[model samples]
Target: MNPNPVVAIAGATGAVGVEMIRCLEERNFPVKELKLLASARSAGKTMKFRGKDIVVEELTEASFKGVDIAFFSAGGGISRKFAQAVKEAGAVMIDNSSAYRMDPNVPLVIPEINPEAALHHNGIIANPNCSTIIAITPLWPIHKVNRVKRLVAATYQAASGAGAAAMEELEQATRAFLSGEPFEQKIIPHPYPFNVFSHNSNVDPETGYNEEELKMVKETKKIFGDDNIRVTATCVRVPVLRAHSEALDFECENPITPKEVRDILAKAPGVKIVDDVSANYFPMPKDASGKDDILVGRIRQDISDPSGRSIAMFVAGDQLLKGAALNAVQIGELLVR
Candidate 1:
């Protein structure tokens, strides 16, 4: 790898794509040159990086020719179509979509949880699902110390996970509803403003689990390298615009207390403890938005479990930042390290 690598952003105009640019700037990743690639329609647009205007180009077979690292936040379709081109160009593709995450050869990595997995990437590295990243980042520390036998996560995802248009639609729909006007939805399946629904991803009729939920289950196992570690998730789309929140219950092998769990997470990288029982304060989407760290709090022993081995906690993280863009950038940083 070059001491200062040439970086490319595949979906430079989209939500996560824009955040990727910001992360590179914020993290001060060494870059010899920057290329911004988007759809043809988004071509000719210019995005700024390191105080210079870089024109967005149409993504093509030749886009990755000189890019040392290609950060792909475009949809899976684009990644599927161009990933090989990226690899053929000899650029390390850090993808932030579901395209190659489950591929046997590809490594699904969250730097905090599985940085070593990235060392084995065969040209492409997959970033886990946004909800999965937010949920699992905090789990890794505890699971590293005390074995986690099972995981139960219920995510209250935000509109940002869908894309920037969905976030705008939510705002538009909210204003229309406030004025007593009928609102039409575009990005999401159901009504957006002041409403919540199951995740919009296709559901498996047999298991009654949505694609988002299934990703959490499968990706967790793959990242943890523990096929036997039981995992289940119920993912829902909430009215929030940015960060995603999850309630996780961990079933461990031995008894653990709330203080022990809290102490573990307090020192864990990429985590922020927000539990303030005196003021009833805890992790909130408003506080987590635009932040790099995943906020974890509301730690307590599971009241329903008599074995004293179960712990419950609430976590919030910016799905676009730490969940997608920052995580991919972190992987890119690791690649050059």
Candidate 2:
């Protein structure tokens, strides 16, 4: 990696791609140059970075030329198509999609957790799923202190997880619902206004688990390097426009308490403790929107476990930031360092 790298963002006009540009600027990443690559339809558009307008270019195999680091936020197919080009260009690819997450050759990375794993990447690193990142950020610290044996997560995912269009659909649908006007749902599968449904990802008939839930389950084990960790999830799409929230319950190998969990998370990186009992405030999507840190709260014991080894908590994080772009950028930073 160059000391000051020429960074390229594939799918630069999308929600996560836009955030990737902002993260680089906000974090003051040493960028010798910036390249914004998107689809042909988005090409010729201008986006701002460092008070300058950079025109978005159509992504091609040749887009990786002279690019030291490439942040890929496009869909899996795009990432797969251009991956070889990126590697052959002598640039590192930090991918946000699930294209190569479970690949043994690609390291699944969360900077706050297994950063060292990123160093072993084979020219590509994979960011974990948004819900997995939100849940596991706080859980990693606790797992370090008392090994987590099992995890059960129920994710309240925002429309933003689908993309910028889905977010706009959410807002537009809400207005249409309030005005008693007919609205057609295009981006999101279900009627998103004032309603909740299972995650938009296709469900597996045999296992009864959606792709989103399966990603959380598999990615958590890979990132933690603990296949023995039992994981299950029920993912749902909520009406929020941004930020994802999760209700997490986990059983540890040893006994753990709320105070211990709080203390552990308070000192953990990329985590913000928001557990307030008297005021009855906990992590919320509204509060977590646009935040870099994952807000965690509602810590308590899961009484269902007779052994008193289970704990429950709530967490929220910006899906486009830490869950996607920021995490990919953080991996790039690790490479540079």
Candidate 3:
């Protein structure tokens, strides 16, 4: 690889797309040439990178030519359509869509838990679902120490996970509620202000859980290299704009305590512990947003269960950064070296 490798950012104007750009710059990724590609609607718009205003180009087969790495956040449809083409263009793709996540050949990486897996990319590596990535960031380190057995989790995801339009819808609905005006809804199936809805979209006729929930259960086991780890989940969409939170009730193979969990997480890379029960210092959406580290708090032992064998905690991370943008950038960083 060259000292400054060329990189392309597909869907460079969307919510996660914009965050990808910032993350690459923040991390000081060596960018000899930065190409921002989007759909025809977004082409011709300009984005500044490395002190120059780079024009957003319409994505085509040629978009990835001469590109060293491509960070994709467009959508599953776009990824399914052009991901292979990007690879054929001789660039490695770090895709943020679910299209290739379950592919046996593609590595669904969190960087914190499985940096080694990033080396096995077959041109396109998948970023795990946002909720699963954050939960595993704190849990994987512990799982390595005390093997996770049966797991149950519920996610409190934010509107930003759905993209910028959903965030705007939440804001509009909240303002409309306060002003005694009619609430409008379109981006999401349900109204967004001060409300919660099942995050599952288009129910799976057999399981009843939404595709997102199913992804969490399956991806967790796959990423951890444990098909035998029993898991179940309930994913819910919350009105928050940025961070995605998860409440995990996991029973491990060994007895685990709050202090031991804190000790392990405090030293894990990309994990920030905030578990102080006396002052009620815990991780929150506002506190986690715009940050790179996953925050874990509300640490306590789950009673009615065997001591040192079970623990319950809350984890939060920026869905746009570590969840999507930062993860993809880190993949590129690892790929270059």
Candidate 4:
């Protein structure tokens, strides 16, 4: 990799793609050149990077030429279509889609957790699912200390996970609801004004788990490199516009205390402690939006477990940043180093 690499952002005009641009600039990533690639519909549009407007180009197989590092925020289909081209062009692709996450050859990486896994990538490194990243970021510290045995998570996902269009639909639906005007939701499956629904991903008939929930379970084990860890999740799509919140309950291999958990997280990279019981304030989506650190609070020992090995906590993180763009950028930073 070049000391200053030419970075290409696939799907540059989308929500996560836009945040990728911001992260690269805010973090002062050593970018030699920036190429913005999107569908033909978004081509010719200009997006700002380092006080300059870079024109968006139609993505093609030829787009990876001269690109040393490619950040892909496009959907799985697009990532799959151009992956070989990126490999052939000799660019390292840090993909933000689920397309290659589970592939044995590709590494699913969260820089804070398992950065060393990224160095062995064949050509593409996959960013974990948004909900998976949020739940696991704080857990990695705890798992390292106590060896998590089981983890159950309920995610409060925002519209941003769906896409930029879904976020716009959420805002529009809220306005229509307030005005008592009939509105049709086009992006999301359910009404987004002030409603919550099960994640829209298709559910498995045998297991009754949606695609999002399955990703959490499988990705957790894969990223942690511990298939023995038990995991389950119920993913919900809330009306929030950005950031994702999660309620996590986990049991460690040995007895663990809340204070011990707090101590571990205090030193964990990419985590912020927000556990203040008296003031009744904990991690909230409003406070977490736009922040790179995952806010964690509500730390307590689970009363249900008499054995004293279980703990509970609540966490929030910007779905588009740490969950997607910033994570990909962090991986890029690792490669450049």
Candidate 5:
């Protein structure tokens, strides 16, 4: 194997940033040197990596100087401002923001399905939206054999996708609601504690779907290499802290039965079939939290379209793992290799 490259992390103190560090250590990615970069406000913070205290440095255009790979979990504005600079400095960028996702030149990647596309990157590789990532990992294997024709999905997302502040907001709001306070809500437009609502992004007038839903439909189709698949999604913000769960109803070109779907997904990489409804053993947010694999459960025949080609299932995955940081790091691994 080629020698490990010097890796740098932008937004080193954020939620996904912390998980990125853990994932790097967990997967034992070749790392000759590790650099942690964050905002000027977080410059003096100290974070442990591989048993060593790694000091956080303020991210600058010059931060990519000796770095060969940079994983960016910063917001879109920071990514738009600095990603190209990092790339120009000779480091490949794996960005975890929506900034470059829709760019025709930038590949929105899911390694399980499209690792090959990472090689064609000019500078940055885009990580798909969190909800989309969790959904597609399990959906792709079935799509490969049966070919999904259309889907109607409803997402139950955790607070982590909105970042650390949002997680904190949910917590604080929950406490406030329990204590009979006004139940202040800001990170999410609706009351988050014990309540679920549509995604906060602006709604599309025609489809009435939020931006997150649109991303799921568009990104899923792109990552699966199928433009003909029609997907309509309703992304919801729920009280869960980590895993994102989706109730998916799929119409496939090839006929599909529950047993075949189970068998196909059971052998699929990056997926775990947890569908035993009689035992209440299907995927749950709490059980799926902190794990990398997407869990599928509650499998059944869709009554509306019981043609054997149409089916419904539920899936849950760690939004921060397979959805964001891990996927970005996997892209980096693919690029470096």
Candidate 6:
């Protein structure tokens, strides 16, 4: 890798893409130049990085030439079409889309959990799903110590997971609802104001699990290298505009306590403890938005399990930062090191 690599941000106008640019600047990653690429409609716009304005260009087959690292967040279709071109251009493509995550050749990574995996990437490394990153950042430390036997997770996902337009739609819908006017649903399938629904992803009729839920299950096992972990998840979309929260219940091979679990997470990387019982404070989306660390709290023993081997907890993290852009940038940093 070049000491100061040239970086490109695909989908530079979208929510995660914008954050990808911010993260690179915030982290002070050594960059000789920055390229912004988006769709034709988004092209010609300008975004600032390192105090300089860079014009966005329409992504084309020639875009990746001479780029040392490319961060992709456009969507799966764009990734599928352009990933090989990125590799052929002699750049490492750290994809933030679901396009290549499950590919056997690609390393689906959360830097805190699988930094070693990034080293083995065959030119393209995949960033895991946003909800999966929020859930597993804390879980991996515990699983390493206790050997998680089974994990059941329920996610409270935000509109940010869908995109910037969905967030705007949520805000618009709320105002319309309060004014006693019907809001037309556009970005999200159902009514958004003060309503919660199962994840809007296409569902599998055989197992009754949405794509997001299954991504959590499969990606967790793959990242941990333990297919026997027995992971299950339920993903729901909430009215929140930014961060995502998840409730996780894990049955470990050895008995564990809430205090012990808390202790483990405090020492873990990319985690911040926010548990305070007396004041009734824990991880919340409002607090987690714009933060780099995943805020974790609400640690307790799973009461249903008399065996004392089960622990439950809650976590909140910025879906756009740590969940998507930051993680991808972290992978790029790994390549540089």
What are the runs in model 1 whose C-alpha is more than 4 Å off?
none
| Model 3, span 18-85: residue lDDT tens | 99889888899988899999999999999988678999999998888899888889899999899878
How does model 4 score by TM-score? 0.99
Over all chains combined, what TM-score does candidate 5 have?
Answer: 0.97
Query: What's the TM-score of every candidate structure?
Result: 0.99, 0.99, 0.97, 0.99, 0.97, 0.99
For model 2, what is the alpha-carbon lDDT of residue 188? 89
Task: Give the C-alpha miss distance for residue 212 in model 1, angstroms.
Answer: 0.3
**What TM-score would you give candidate 3 relative to the actual structure?**
0.97
lDDT of each prediction vs. the true structure? 0.93, 0.93, 0.88, 0.96, 0.89, 0.94
Q: Write the per-residue lDDT of candidate 4 for residues 41-78, one digit (tens) a residue.
A: 99999999999999999999999999999999989999
In model 2, the worst 10-residue window by lDDT is: 320-329
Ranked by lDDT, the better of candidates 2 and 5 is 2
Of 5 and 6, the candidate ranking higher by TM-score: 6
Clashes of 5: 0
Error of 2 at 181 (Å): 0.9
Candidate 3 has its poorest 10 consecutive residues by lDDT at 299-308
Global Cα RMSD, each model = 0.7, 0.7, 1.2, 0.5, 1.4, 0.7
Better of 3 and 6 by lDDT: 6
Error of 2 at 317 (Å): 0.9
lDDT at position 334, candidate 2: 96
Task: Encode model 6's per-residue lDDT on 1-337: one tens digit a residue.
Answer: 8879999999999999999999999999999999999999999999999999999999998999999999999999999999889989999899999999999999999889989999998899999999999998899999999999898999899999999999999999999999999889889998889989999999999999999999998998899999898989989999999999999899999899998898899899999999999999999999999999999998999999999999988999999999999999999999998
Q: How many pairs of residues in model 6 come into backbone collision?
A: 0
What is the per-residue lDDT of model 5 for residues 1-337, given as tens digits with 9 covering 90 to 100?
2258899999989999999999999999889998999999999899999999999999999999978888999998999999778878888888999899989898989999999888888888899999998888988888888898999999999999889989999999999989998866777788899999888888999988889999998998778878899999988889989889999999999788888889989898889999776788889889888898999988887778756789899999999999998898888789767
**Candidate 4, pairs of clashing residues:** none
